[model samples]
Target: MLISVQALRALAAWVVVCHHFMQIFFDFHATGPIGQFFTDKGAVGVDIFFVISGLVIYLSTQNKDMPAGRFMVNRIIRIVPAYWLYTAAMGLLILVAQPLMPHAAIDWTHFILSLLFIPSENPGGYGMYPTLNVGWTLNYEMLFYLLFSLVFLFEQRHRPLIVAAALFAVSEVLTRLGVISHFYRNDIVYEFLLGIAIGVFHRRGWIANGLWLPLLAIVGGLLTIYHLAPSDRLLHWGLPSAVIVLACVSLEPYFQGNRLLKVLGDCSYSVYLLHVLVLYGGWLAATRYGLNPYAVFAVCVPLIALGGWCSYQWIEKGLYLRLKDWLDKRRNDGELKALSRQEY
Candidate 1:
């Protein structure tokens, strides 16, 4: 089960990596079929991520003593350090090499918002992008974490139900109010609910174990998505994304995980965060050497993967462990002091 989820995490991260590379390297409407295909598939990856997130959260927190504040703090500690590091790196790059990335600029407000995981209009003329363009999704993720934290108030068994009901209610109300949040309103958010549903099914053993059935669902859902237009993205992409996630979770026990894919999955956050920088730098280097798009592709992915791995080891894993240990010790010490005072 863990392997399948990890593999999906790897898959989702790379899909987005390829998707952005195609978009950034070429025009918005790609002249070629491959570009357009990747672009279409890439968007689905994000939707898949949302679904997976909900599923993971439910699965992890179920029957666990995770307080709302603790949940938020853990999420913050896990996400913010690496994100801020990368964002600062990006800011430094913009300061030094403004000519390389024409659209990218040092808009202080945007940079601050990016660090805070607040969505803002990009100074680069990109719509509602944070300083690190990919961090836009992090903004949504932060919001989701916040909302999910509230469910901690409920009992373990009841939390999943609250998640589904609360998310659905909020989504429906936002839809009715015509609230204009490109970040978290409407159907996109429901992808998480789809994930929560999958988690419930998996936890309850309701899903039949198998390869063929889940594989078929994935293939069929993707095929349906391939034919549809990108409009009403939730229906077109989100539904299929959920279907894919559900299938993946269903196949968890049966599927033997690939080592490389699992490694990538372990570094999935780093992959998603750092790939853009690799792509950007690769583009500049490729052009400098008169390397073609294929060469650029060849070089970019390996570097991105390598960089993500390194970043994961050092910043994400290393820093995270240190912070978590320190936090745990502080908590333990505080508890001891309180106990001692009560004894007195």
Candidate 2:
């Protein structure tokens, strides 16, 4: 993995954590520069995430012929365990604290849909956000995984076209139906496609490896953030994400991983999943103590990072290892049974 890409993962997760903290805990309009900057540009972090997903997912399969079932198992193992744990926890919290958190009403339909990673019009009518707000992005990630798995079923040369077309078709149908909100549309799906394009180009040796790569990445990322707004996240944020990803891949040969940044990157998924719980807890504490919102925001930023690291260590890592071990054992058992049958 590219060190730069890992650094970006940590950076993007923090950007989103701060953005949500500022907007949800502190009023965006009144919180001064911190609010203004993060509120305006924070969502680009998700774009960065999507692009990274594309690059990493595509690159991982290079020169390999993985079974589609096995490919999906690995993806599910990586994503579902941590997500389901947090989702069930959030649902339990909402159940117990319904009166205290009026803004978060639980709908059984929405809850089930969220657990399934299916995009739907939220039965609660509070936008397309699920029981846990961050799960919306997971819907896209799962969709991309499903689409990208085509390489296992078809020739790799034909996969880019197949996946791209499938993405376009799905988004067009959903957008045309008007049943779901635009947030659930395929517009954002293009970001994953952008990442796929980056991977394809990189593998083809089309992207130049040079000193200029880093410079372009920095400038493009800055300009993207400077122009970012509440709308058009796909274009405004996605394009720059591609640029940065391209730069990162191009300069990968020159970069070495920083221990701290690599650790944060390893924990980025946990950070993204668990930060909201930390933010909510901190907000409750702040309100009880009558602390100013900005002070709460200042405190929550570091607290969220701490919470993420802890979750990574205790929840994500443990679950992943246990699941992986069980899977390896299962595979060994299946192989043993086949050999025994042959011997008989």
Q: What is the C-alpha RMSD of each candidate to the true structure, in Å?
A: 2.2, 2.5
Count of residue pairs whose backbone atoms collide, per candidate:
0, 0
Q: Relative to the true structure, how large is the alpha-carbon lDDT of every model?
A: 0.81, 0.80
TM-score of each: 0.93, 0.91
TM-score for model 1? 0.93
Please, what are the lDDT tens digits per residue for candidate 1 over residues 87-161?
998888788778867888877888898898876688878688887888877776787788889887877777767
On TM-score, the candidate that comes out on top is: 1
lDDT string for model 2 (19-86, tens) is 88876676456357767888778778888899899888988887789888888888898898889888
Q: Model 2 segments beyond 4 Å from truth?
A: 174-184, 228-230
Give candidate 2's total backbone clashes. Answer: 0
Show where candidate 1 strays beyond 4 Å. Answer: 168-182
Model 1 clashing-pair count: 0
